[model samples]
Target: MLRRTVLLTFAGAALGGSLWQGAAHASEGRSPYGPLQPPDDVGLALPEGFTGRLVARSGHRVAGLAWHAAPDGGACFPDGDGWIYVSNSEIPLLGGASAIRFAHDGTVRDAYRILSGTNLNCAGGATPWRTWLSCEEAYRGRVFECDPYGSRPARPRLAMGRFKHEAAACDPDREVVYMTEDEKDGCFYRFRPTDWGDLTEGTLEVLCHGMVWKEVPSPAALVKATRHQVDDARHFNGGEGCHYADGVCYFTTKGDNRVWAYDAKASTLEPIYDADSPLSGVDNITGTASGELFVAEDGGNMEINVITPQRVAAPFLRLHGHSRSEITGPAFSPDGTRLYFSSQRGRRGILTDGHTFEVTGPFTI
Candidate 1:
C-alpha cells in the first residue's frame, strides 16, 4: 500500500507565502552548519547574490528531484498545488518502493510507494513528455517512469534495460533517450524508440571509445560489437548525471569525475572535462537557458560546480561542509528564473535527514 502524508505547515511556517518568507523566519538568517570543510570534506557555498535555505527536510531518504509548474500560478508550495516529485531510495522498514510529492509551497502533499524491495535511489531525470524517470543505482536495477500527479499507475520501461542506471535524459524531437551506467568500466548507452513518443521496442547500444567509436553502422551491428550482452554483473562505476543539449548529450562519471560528450549523429563519445583538483563524484547536472551547465558534486565538497561553455568547472555554490549533504537533482524552472536542487544529508557520513532547496539567482557565466 502507498503511504501518503501532507504537511501544510512545516517548522511552524504556513504555506502560500513566498518560498523565502517562511524560511527567513525559521532560520533567522543563519545558514545550516556541518562538520566538513573545503579543501578537505566540507559543505557548499553560494554566490554573492544567492542564498540557500532548507525548504523541507526529514521527510524520507531523499534522492533526485523533479519540479513542475503549478497549475495555479503560485510560488512553489508543498501541498498538492505544484508537483515536486522526489525519490525516496530507502526507508528503515519500508524497503525499496517509495517516492514523495510536495506542493509548490513546500508542503508534504502525497506519497507513492511503488517497486518495493529496491535500493539506492541515487538520481533521476525528467522526460520532455512530462514523466519522471527514476533510476535504481543497484546491480540489476531498473528504470521507472512515474506520474507526478499520482493519478496514473507507476511502471518500468523495461526497454531501457536493467542495470545500475544513474541518470537519463530524453530528446523529444528525435525520439532518442540516453543513459549512464554506474560501474568502474561503465559504458554509456543510447536508446532509439520505434515511435516518436513511445519507448517500447527500441535498440540499446554501448559506447566503445576507440577509432570505431565515431562510426555508425546498422543498429543491430552496433549492439553486437559493444558486447551489448545483458548480464548480471552489477559492479561498475561509470555513470552519474547526464543532459542533452542541441544535438549532443553530455554525461559524467562518478568514479573518475570525467565528463563526456556524445554526438548522436557521429555515434561517438568525446572527452569534455577532466579536472584533477577534487574527486568529481558528480551526482546530477542540468543546462541553463544561456547554455551553461551546472553540476552537483556529491563528493568531498558538497557544492554545485559550474561548467562553462568552454568546459571549465569552478566552485559555483558551496554548502559549507560535508555534513553528508551531497548535492543532487539540479533543475531550472521552466522560465529558467530559479534553480531547484536536493540534498541527501545522510549518505556521505552526515547524520542528518535529507531535504530540498531553491536558489534564486541572476546567474551569470
Candidate 2:
C-alpha cells in the first residue's frame, strides 16, 4: 500500500475525494486476528474474546420506524463523539438507506431513513466530508448523497452516469470517485467532479485496458447505457463492493469470484485473489486503518473474511443458521474495535428477514 508521503504528488491533480476514516480492504492467507472460535448464543462465530449483538431486524421497531429489508452495502460515518452506520435497501421501488446512530458508548440513540423513493439501493461510499453516497442498483441508477445526520434532504447525482450501479469508493489522492457496475459485462468508472466534495456535476470516465481512462461518449446516456457506450471498456463480472485507502482502490466482482486492486498513484489494476481462494462470492469491501481488508460474502458460508497486510485472507467471523442468507455490509466503528454488518436474509428470511449486527472484540490492527 502507498503511504501518505508517496501519494502527495498526485493529490493535487485529483482535487477532492474521500478520506474515509473507517475504511476496510485484503489479506494474508492466515488472518492476523487469529482463527474463529465456537458459535455464541446468537449462532455467530467469532475469534475468542469477541462478542456479537443484534442491532436491528427488518420489520422491527427501531427508534420510531420499521427497519428496512434486504440491507445491502453500508459505510460508517463519525458523528460528534459517536458515529453512524448507513445501510442501503436492495429491494426494488422505494428502496433507500437508513442510519443507526450510536452514542460514544455504543448506544443506539436513533434509527431512521436517510434516502427514500429510490430503486434497489445497493451499495454506496462514505465521503470524507461525512456524507453517504447512496446508489441505486437499477437500470440507469443514480447516486444520491444522503446526510446521515438527517438534517438535509438527499439529492440525486445524475452526472455520475446511468447503468447497473453497484458500489463506490472515493480516492482523495486522485481527486475522483471510483464506482463499480453490477452487470456481468459492466465496466469500472470514475466520476471527476467539477469541484472536490461536491457531487452535483462531474465527468464520468470509463476504465479501459492497461488502466487507461476515457470519458463516456454520453455520460447521461439518455438513449443508451453508459457501459455500452465505450467500445473498449474493461468488463468485470458482476462488480460488487469498492473501497479506497492509502492510495489504493480495491473492488470485488462476484461473477468470476475475484478481488481486484487498483493503485491510484501507479495507475495500475490487477487481480489480487481468484476463484480458487477461500473467499468466494465476493461482494461489498472495506479496509482497516491498520491496512487489513474485510471482504463480505453474498453467498456461500455466510462469513466475512479478512485480508492481512501480507495479502493473506482468512475467515474473521461466521454466522451460523443463516446459510440461506448473504452477508451485505461490513464496516468498522470510528474506534475500529466494533464491526458492523448484516445478514441480508436472516435464518428464516426470504427477503424481509434481514438483520443488522454488531461484533466487538480485540480487533487486531
Per-candidate total of colliding backbone pairs: 30, 19
Tens-place lDDT per residue, model 2, 1-365, is 32111011112111113332222333235666778888988889898788999999999998887999999989898889999999999898979999999999899899989999899999989998889998889988989999999999999999898888898998887789999999989899999999999989889999998678999988778898898888888899999999888777889989987877777876866665664446768998988877777899988888898765544678898899999999998999988988999999899957799999999988764
| Residue 31, model 1, lDDT | 19
| TM-score, per-candidate, Cα-based | 0.69, 0.91
User: What are the per-residue Cα lDDT tens digits for candidate 1 across 1-365?
Assistant: 33212111112211122111111111011212222233313233565555455544544333342222100001111223454534435222222333455555544455554434545555666777666676777666667766554556667777777666778888665677878877776667767777756675676655554523221233333244222453322222577888887656777777766666665655544445555443256667777655566777775566666655433346666665445556666776554556666666634444235555666656642
Candidate that would win on lDDT: 2
RMSD of 1: 13.6
Off by over 4 Å in 2: 1-28
The candidate that wins on TM-score is 2
Q: How accurate locally is residue 7 in candidate 2, as Cα lDDT from 0 to 100? A: 10
Instruction: Report how far off residue 251 is in candidate 1 (Å).
Output: 0.3
